[model samples]
Structure formats: C-alpha cells, structure tokens
Target: MIKKLAIDDLRPGMEVVQMSSSLWEHLPNLYTQPGPIKSEAHLKLMREQGYQHAFVEVEVPGEPLEKRLDAILADRMKDAPIKERVPFDKEIEVADRAYKSAMNHAHRLINDAKMGRKVDFEGTVETVDGIVNSAVRNPDTLLCLSKLAQYDDYTYGHCINVSAIAVVFGEFLGLSRDELTRLGVAGMMHDLGKTAVPERIINKRARLSSAEFEEIKRHPQYGYDILKRQGDVPEDVLEAVRDHHEKFNGKGYPANRHRSDTSALARIISLADVYDALTSDRSYKDAILPNKALAIMYGMRDQAFDPLEVQLFIKCLGIFPSGSLVKLSTGFYGVVYESNPNLPLMPKIKIILDQDLRPIPSELVDLAARQAVGDENLEILECADPTDYRINLKPYLTRTR
Candidate 1:
C-alpha cells in the first residue's frame, strides 16, 4: 500500500504520482511515479497539485542536464532565503520612519486647529512630500510594508495604507517616478480635513446620527481651507483631497461636484480610497473581502467612480489578488499566494481543503499551465471569500519566505 501522506509530508526520495484532488483519497495507486525522483520531480509534483503549487523537500531533476541532483540540493541549502532578498524588515523600517515624520506634523496641525490657532500649511506639505519621495524612490520597500495593518493608531495606519495604495495605482497608470511621488503625497494628505472633526464623530463605534454625518461631511471643506492657506500643494492634489467624494450624479456633499468638474487624479484617488476602506475592518463594520469589494465598486462605476478608472484598477490588482481565497473546479479550497504578471488571471495557489471544508494536506497549483493533459476539469472554478468560509488569512498572509 502506498502510505498516504499530506502534501507537506512530501520529502526527498519520496516516490509519488500525480492525482486529482478527488482521486488522491480514493485511488491512491492510480497515481504513481518511479522511485527517488529528484528536483524536476518536485516541481512536477507542485504543478500536478495545482497551478504554481509547492511542497516540502521533494527534489526533482533540473533543466539543462545538471551533473548531479545531490550537488544541486547542496547548492540550494547554501543559498539565502527569498525573504532576505526582499528585505521586508528594511521596508518596514523606512515606512515607520516616514509615518512618524508625517504624523508629527499632522497631529500638531490638528491640535492648532482645535485650539483656534492658525495652521502651518507649509509645514504639513513639507512633511507629506518627504514621505512621498521616500516611497517613490523605493516602491517595493513600501509595498512590502503595506502588509502590516496594525501599528500604533488606526488613523495613522489608515493614512499610510491609503498612501501605499495610491502609489501602487499610480504606478499602474504609468506615471513617472516623480509623478508617483506627488500623487502619493496627495493620497497621504487626502484626509487632512478629518483632523478638524471632533474625535467623538471620527472614532464613533456606532452608526452616526444624521447630524453627526452632516458634521462629518464638513471635513472636506476644513481640509481645503488648510491646504488653501498653505499654498504649496498643486491644484490637482488639493482638488482631489477636497472633492474626492463628489459623484457623477451630483449626489455627493459639500458642493456636490460632478464628474465633469473633477480632475483625473482626484477621480483615481477617490476610487482607491473607497476600495481600500471597504476591504479594511473598521470600528462599526466588518471587513469585506477584496473580490466582493471590487464587485461592489464595479456596480457603482459611472455613478460614484469613473468606469474607466475602475476597470484599470481591476486590471492592476487582478481578479483575485494575493491573499485571496478561491475554489477550484476539483472541489478544493485554496489561498492565492502570488500572481504572475505574465498570467494575471492564473496565480500560484496553496490548496488547504476539499469541497466539504475538511482540512487536507496543502498543495501548490498553477492555473495557467495544467499539471497533466486532459485534466481540464481540475481548472479553477471561481474566486471565493475566506470570510464566507470562516477562513482566516492572517497566518497564510504573514507566512515568511
């Protein structure tokens, strides 16, 4: 009998054959590989498991006819971990530095406004520009840091998240490095007016009363006033920060600016802000998954969002982003780990369970190329929310290299 092993149980010198998820349990013998398959075999096993799949310790043969499999394994053992090259820690350090610097100026301005003291708008602009330049010069560093949601204060965290997201979007839009930096600054300062609002309304855990909501709407004007006094911010950035909420249908507040009145960057910032807000957990509402949030935003395109910009956002992030849950055609649940830019719709995934939600040994799957021919039914079925299945993504999302 071929002893059944979970996906992680796979190791060096293990002989195995590829089988569909359904067949893995019922007909173990149906899939069999000759003994002691090395490195290429491990890669094959991962593909056989699913698109862009992975497992532990299986060494299949390499391409280009290596001299010895043992030598290759020895070489790999000497190589550094992937995370080391990615430098996540360094990225976090940079983001923390930027955040701390920006927050100091922001909070001080808030305090001044609260005390009825004149605001130092130039100082705030300078702080925002400093952070934006740091991110634009080293985009990947900030992107790595974006994975952290819980830092000191939720407000400051939100600000950093919004800035990171805007930079990502700006990159996708093909903005130049300098342009991305400016746009990022605009994103960081987008909510500057919120400082003028009372903490009671800003941090309210419950639904806001109508009057409170009305008060909340005035933050845009407050932000505009602060920016206007400073005189350093570009017109487009100021407009985006102040009028992001305005809609095409003229139902938005403050001035109810229409689509025709809003600038392109303002529209993009608005869309990014709303998308991030919906996907993030908040005081009064549970977080929605990115896929569902995208769907909701798609539904609102043309009314609240620019239809073209929404489509571009979708293109930038893919159908299911990294850290999303999905269901495969073979009736298995998996988490998307990385998306191949060359094949956006098909990403590398790690299988976690079967159709009934029972835990199974994890496997890696790459949807772009099927592991075995005539296995069309094993293709991806659809995207799913982990929340719908009560699956927590934190562990997988935080998995180290």
Candidate 2:
C-alpha cells in the first residue's frame, strides 16, 4: 500500500512512490520519481530541498503508518490552544455576499477599462470597503470561499480573490483601516492592465512566443496607465498596480525596480496576486493545491518574492490553509475548516469519511482540542486530493454556520 511517511522515518530500503506534491517544477533538480531510498544522504538532500513528507511503499509494517503518524500528531497537539472560530454558516453568508459584490464590480471595471471608459473610483472604494469589513470580521470565511474556483471568468474571480487575500494579509500586518482599504483597492485593480491586452493573448492555452510574452509583460505598465488616467486614484494604488509584478531581487519585469524601490503595498499585493493565480484553476493548467502552492511560494522566497513577506503570508494563512483536503490519522478524509494561526498544524477539520473510506455524516473536528470523541488519537496523516476521491467540497464548505 502507498503510505505517507515523514522525512525523519524514511529508511534506505523503502521505495518512494510519489512526491508530496508536484513542486519539482520550481526546483528542477529535485528528484520526483518513484525510487528506492539510496542513503541517509539522500534524505538529507530532500529535507534541504524543503520536502517534509513523501508517499512510499511499505511492506513490513507492524501497525498502519497512518495510525503511527496520528499518534505522533496527537501527542504534539496536546497543549495546542483552542480558539473559538466564527460560525461556519455565518462566515459563508458573509463570504457569499462579498464574493458576489466583488465579482460584479470586477466585471464592470474590466469592461469599462476595455472600452476606454474611466473606472468608477468611488465604486471601487465601496467594493473594497465591503471586502475589508468581511476580512476584518473573519478572514478565513472569504479565504475559504475563494477556493471555490469554479468561476466563469478567471480575471474577475482572480481579482476578487486577490483583493480578499490582500485585505486579510494587511490586517494581519496590523495596517490601519485606511491602509487596508488602499491595499484592497490595489489588489482589485492590479490586473486592470490585462483588460488592455488582446483577449486571444490573455486566454491562450499554449506558451507565448517571445514577442507575445513581451506584450504580456507590459501589463503592469498598462494597468498603471489605465488607473493613472482616473486622476483621483491613490498614488499608492497606482504604484501597486505597476509594481506588483516586480521582484524583490531586481529580476522582475517592466522597470525591473528592486527591493526598496517597490512600495510596501505593492509587495503585499504581489504575494497575494501570485498566490491566488497559482491556486485558481485556469484554462491552460490545473490548479495546485493550496498547501503545495504555499510550498512553491516558500521556495521562491528571495527569488521571486520578498522572503519576510512570504514567511508572513504563510503565517497569516497557517500551515494547512482553509479548503485543504487531508487524510486523518484515524483513516478518514476531511476538509480543513479553519486554521488556528497559533497552532497551524492542528487546525479544525470537517470530517466527511470514516475509517473504512465510507461516506459519513460530516462532523467538525478540532485537532487542537484536548479530547475528541471516538478517536482521541486523531491527527492528519497527509494531504489528499479531492478529485482522487470524487468528493464535492462546495456544499460542505458553503453550508450555513
């Protein structure tokens, strides 16, 4: 059987069946195929490359590896603090309203920009205000709802998602209310330049030729131009739209401005922008799981993004962010319901399957709780793909609190 094993428990005899996720694209030299563990040196190299777990073939097991991992997790979670969460139903209600409002505003803004009409700055502020309120009330709700990536328009959905994410991250950073509003506006309008690009180029399913790629890269400047013409837009908002694609190491596009040249708002929006794009399903490629996206972003720290900002982003989202599908130590499948930043690894989960892999009535589980019914030793074994099990998480996730 394919079992998920922690890096520390790996032995030379075991065969690696799969990587925890397809992150090798970011680290080209990292080995990703199924292979026999060569030596402790190999394990060391994998750890150095940021791999924490892998799926391996196990033949000589005393107890199931899942149970063993769960026991370890439960032990570690004994002292984890249990914080009360916003009721799921209430959060879903708020998220639904915010998402619809953002989507409507994004569609209008994009269409208006395409027609050379000035964007409604007051309308943008009002939309962002609602997003900021939802984020400050309970960031996880909108964040979790954002994971429902079955949208008709990628651009609109992406802008809304990025805006919600930026607001949450801004709040986490202790930005003033005014600052959060600006960050939200920046995120909502960061991709406005894409509207100026040809529809064919924007939705192309294949790699772009050099000339086409260059045209695509002009989006930051294009977005800046569009927003700047509005006249009343904030300077910080314009800078954020223009510099969101710039890298911290001076390697990013357009002006190639580096580090201190980029404003703090732009840096924050940049992380959110890339993160939402990576996790959202697109016409060209499948979306990576949230945990995997975070890992890839972590690997890109100091290269594509600011290291401290990346770390803070991960901290803000927690280890297993909302919408992650995980297999519990008790041999059940569940969706991450909420994250406890203080106890990231032990966030609350909503159990959907029982140990036998049979469908069961959903139940909320808090891994940080001192005592859980039926399975006191419950713990997450590893992340699982909802597609693999043909599970539809939308109903469960969007249900009323």
Identify the leading candidate in terms of lDDT. Answer: 2
Q: Model 1 Cα displacement at 339 (Å)? A: 3.5
Query: What TM value does model 1 have?
Result: 0.62
Q: Lowest summed lDDT over 10 consecutive residues: which window, candidate 1? A: 51-60
Model 2, poorest ten-residue lDDT window? 64-73
List, residue by residue over 363-396, the lDDT tens digit for candidate 1: 7677766543544556567777666777664444
What does the lDDT come to for candidate 1?
Answer: 0.61
Could you give the C-alpha RMSD of every candidate to the true structure, in order shown? 22.5, 22.4
lDDT of 2: 0.78
Give the TM-scores of the predictions, in the order they appear: 0.62, 0.76
- Per-prediction count of colliding residue pairs? 19, 2
The deviation in Å at residue 268 for candidate 1 is 1.2
> Per-residue alpha-carbon lDDT of model 2 for 1-401, expressed as tens digits?
34446778788878875443233335444345578989889888888987776656655436422234335334433443343556766777777787888888888888889998877665677678888887777778777878864578888899888888989887776566777777899999998998888988887878898988999999999999988876667677899899999998999987899967888788888899989989877777778888889999999998888776787788778778888889988788888988877778888898888876687888888888834345568788888877767777878787632
